[model samples]
Target: MADFGEILESIGDFGLFQKLLLFALCFPNLILPFQLSSLVFNHADTNHHCNADWILQVGPNLTKEEQLNLTLPRLPDGSFDPCKMYVPMDWDLSAIREYGLNETTTCTDGWVHNDTIYDATIVTDFDLVCENTNIFRAAQTIFFAGVLVGAVLFGPFSESFGRKRATQIPMVLMLIFTVVTGLSPNFYVYLASQFIVGVALGGFRINSIILATEWIGVAQRSYAACLSQVLAALGQVMFLAVVYFVRDWRIDQFIMAGPLGFIVVYIWFIPESARWLLYRGKTTDAKELIQKAAAINKRTVPDSLLDKALEEKPVEKGGIKMLFASRVLRKYFLTITFAWCAVNLAYYSLSLNVGKFGLNIFLNQLIFGLSEIPVHFFCMWSLEAAGRKLSLMGALIVGGVLCLLTLAVPQSNYVAIATLATCGRFLMNGAGSICYVYFQELFPTAIRQTATGLGSTASRAASMLSPVVNMLEIYHFTIPTVVIGSLALASGIMAFLLPETRRTELPDSTEEAEGKRGPKLSNPATRDCEDIQATKL
Candidate 1:
């Protein structure tokens, strides 16, 4: 019986069909940054001060300077205290400038936001300042909480219902929730919308991989995986460009959501995974898609090929249980999950906390987005040359070390600090790209999505903790970076323990995953590693 790999070899592997497939699959990734990093724009706190109605009473007739002098208390820096104002007492409008009120209180009426920075934001609109700061973190946490839930749900969903539907359902929901978020009239509604958006995004994250990687050949799989990640960087640039002009948070949401809606129509062009169809005993369906693919790629397939490809091989029921049942599988599961958690935590730590760098945040964000582009090319070269395990470890170790070194760069030299941070961001982008391909390659096809989804759950769990870590600036400045950098370092060391999957045929069954894979195991030596360590027992 011919394996899927054999069938791919018979026809063109990197043919026109696969190239088109790669492009179609990248759209979701391009939109992902909006849901992932929109918090940067949405949660921004514009300059503000206490809004005392009595001050306005004096301000209707007085200049702005006189009203601020009478109503707001200046901090040590001579800037008005946003959270506090002079208590309204015995203020004569006739001599407002002369009237002095010493007693100060929290802003009881509301805040006067500086519209120049943002028309309105989640922070400014909802008053997430002062004692309510924790609520802001809670809101960000709730979004990742939804992603954690999705990590559990989408795995089995992709396995059972098929990858195309799995991809479509979440995409449609993402569009709907994003649109609703923009239209949200109140804070609670926005929170709910964000949670739902995250849920849908989680669904997209898992299914997009299944759709993209399942169709490509092993040799060029790294290219497909890395190129898809480049879209994530592209999405960040798009977010900046859109928000640069559309400063209103609601309008920004609207602009981002619009493309997602249009994409729903275009996704119809993307075909379901033929490999998944074969896994489910839908051989006829798989053959039909393969025929269509051959036609699209302008390749010829023998008439008997379908019959040989349909030859049955026993497939195990792979899930969370199957992963832990064997010692080898258990080790693989634990190591990858922890690696995912550490890498994601470190990656998002810098990605989310752009404000803490003490630089012009917009420029910092632009640089961070730009930094990831080179990483895609780096992954393309390194994953092929050094193979998966070596490249992955290199990225994790380097990214972690660079992030830790960021602490040594004095904050006074904002440019130096920002440069080191961008380099850290660059390395993690490579680490993360390799991890995405590694997750799919590591596990059995039967349970691959489930295991990948579970890993995603771990990563999202780490991401959920990030807001709290980022919030730790109130207690200590270095703590968040320390925690994430430590995680990256630890995970990088653990990367050595797992089996290398580069150039190895993806495991099709739990038994295959459990079986011994000495360096000489796989038949294809074209792209397999030279050293025994790449496929060591």
Candidate 2:
């Protein structure tokens, strides 16, 4: 039985065919950032105060400033209290001013929103303020919850049905749901629509990585993975381009959905994973696709090589049960999943808190997108040079230290705090990029998608909790930093437990995953460390 990597090498691994396919697969990443980071804009905080228009009937001639002064209470800073109002009484304007009102209570009428920063947002439209402030976080959490659900469902779907269906169906669903989200009349409707959009996002994201990785050879898999992430970071920058101009959340949704319409059509032209076809015993289909790829690359696979490939019949074992049946795989699953969870937890901790940096929201967001681009580019080299384990571990541990150092900086020095936070974001994001390639290479093709999906599930679960954890800052300024930094440190320590997959082909069976076979096929030099580790285990 010929290895898939050998076949990929023979058919021109990173040639014209693979490049075109990778381009098609990576294009959607540009749009995904809109949905992923939309919360920052969609629920942007604005200046607001309790409505006190009830006094307007008696004080018809009163100026807007005088009306607010008479109808609202003041805090120590001399600003009108945002959530409180003075009790209204039937009196003339001059008489009301003469006799001061002492009683204060929560706003009986709805709040008035300032539209200076954002023309409209879910926060303004729904009055998600004061008592309802937590609702915005809840909605964002629900969206990530949907991402978790989609990952759970699509993992088996991709492994059983095929990667093409997993990718295309979600593209269509994301398009439909994004439009639905934009047209949502009520906050509840918006939440439901965003949840479905998240579901579609989860399905599309994991399978895209798997399908692209499966088609590329071991040597260039780093390029395939890192470049896709670089594109995703560029997508984040593109998100700023769209949102910076269109401030309304509804219009933003509509604009972001526009690109997916063309991508859905173009995606159909790309072929399915030939490696997946062979693993499923669809040799005829795999053979035809491989031959076509060869023709496109201006190369040829010998008939004898093709004959031997068809003769390779894999024993099919898959699903969640198969994932945990082996002890070594279970260890890999737990370690990688924690790495996924920790990276996401720390990543979103900084990303979602873009406002605290004391910079323009659009500029801060641009800084975030720009910073990630180079981190991924660096990952492209370090993943191949220092190897996966050290790269991820070093990134997380160093990033964690930066996050903790923010606690020592004075709150008045926004510049210093911002600098530490930005550095942490850079390292965490780099670790995240490495995980996409590292996780795919760690598992066999039989349950590879399932493993990836499960890792995504764990990451989404962590992301879902990130907003809640960030909310802890209300209790103590240092609470969120302590928690996120601690998790990053622990997760970096856990990375040492995972085997280094550098210069190793993706395994195709449990036997190969367990080191019973195929390790020698890629590089005996690299496999020695893995085999020795396996023996000790």
Candidate 3:
């Protein structure tokens, strides 16, 4: 009888079957983070009780004399009339009093007294404003920033430690911080917890993606990665139901954080990446993991295959410096970095702002999340059949153009503009999903994780600016939309300059990558001349 390792080696050496299995294993990890985005968006609302009656009643009820008193605070020139302070409809005095609204002073004082409770409730209602939006955006930025750090460090760490141990560390952290986030008593504590969670979340994201890719064959890598995100989108929808039922942000946080506890159980079910094991010179462990994988797949492996796979081990341990060693590698880095930045800017800006559009915030988010299913399939089909560059360019151009057209739709045409904006969102979401998979394929195994992390960091840098851009856009929608559109268009054009990777085997080295298309790879350079030229145009 063949041992488990021998069976796994016969499964076509990490092809479609392994990719599919990895997709299944990695699905939950992907969804958990994306769904958390919605949780943050939901909680970011500051104006949840805006329609609460007591809040409205706190304003001056304007008896003839009181109305005159209200007018007294105005400028003598009548330019700043205090009487113009209008109460919005739907504010409930009863709800305010029940929640401890002080009726003696205007409702404002009382509202501020119970601000935390009210804020928490309103966050559920999805009325987040500037401060809240900033907090939410900041949390996401820090999270991605953590991802950047993790991606860079994880490659080396995973190389030294076993891949299984490296992957589990983040999962453990995610569980711990997630629980801490729920128990946070104050905003500062909550923010800190989120930042910590970001670190864990970041690690989990990179490890899961890289591990899944490594275990699969090149032919199936793109589909596997894309499928992971697709399941993540499904998780987004599932979380909608979770948020709807849970209602409280803290409770929702706990719900999201809790699932990670079970992931540890995967230790028994999931095997370490054979590639990482091989690279680390642990032929015995690598062979063991491969055998286990074959057993899971119900296949038999031959002993001869395992003997043949035990190849050369390096004399010197390779570090991240290896990523920077060639001109072509540098080019790949720059292209992916800029591309990720543009994709993230457009992708996140739209996701963060979706609540502002005139639709039921929860329902709209659910719809938006669900839209990714079909859109992802479209992306997969287009990417496989059409060139990656062409598909990406088309999506970017369409999304950018649609965003620009949103400016033409009058504010009075809120419904029409919102519909158009959603279309733009759909395009960007699909494009972004494709870009993640595409970027992975563009780089070789040596620097794949490093390249991804750098690209992700660029994207995070862009994301850090998104809140500022969003705030600016609030003053005038047209200006920000135009800026986003311009960036998207530029990204599409930049993509045109990069080489296509479809049907080509992944480049073994930076020098090989450059030599395949345009340039000769020399010593590792910090920046690629070609990428600089593309950006300059």
Q: Sort all candidates by lDDT, best to worst.
A: 2, 1, 3
Point out where model 1 deviates above 4 Å: 94-99, 515-537
Which of the two candidates, 2 or 3, achieves a greater lDDT against the reference?
2
Q: Please list the Cα RMSD from the true structure of every candidate, rounded to 1 decimal place.
A: 3.7, 3.7, 9.8
Tens digits of per-residue lDDT, candidate 1, 1-537, equal: 566776776566789898888888786688889877778888886687788767665557767777787788888998888889888876567665665788889988888787586777888778888767568778888998888887778878999988888888888888898989988888899989999888888887778877878888888888666887888898898898877777788888888877898889888668888888898888888989988888988887787877887878566774778888878888988987898888778877788888667787788889988889888988998887888899888888888988888889777888888888889889887888888888888888888888889899889999888888887867888888788888888899999998777676677776667654433233446545544555784
Estimate every model's Cα lDDT from 0 to 1: 0.81, 0.87, 0.62
TM-score of each: 0.94, 0.95, 0.77
Candidate 3 lowest-lDDT run of ten: 104-113
- Using lDDT, give the best candidate's number: 2
Best by TM-score: 2
Candidate 2, superposed: residue stretches over 4 Å from native: 516-537
| Candidate with better TM-score, 1 vs 2 | 2
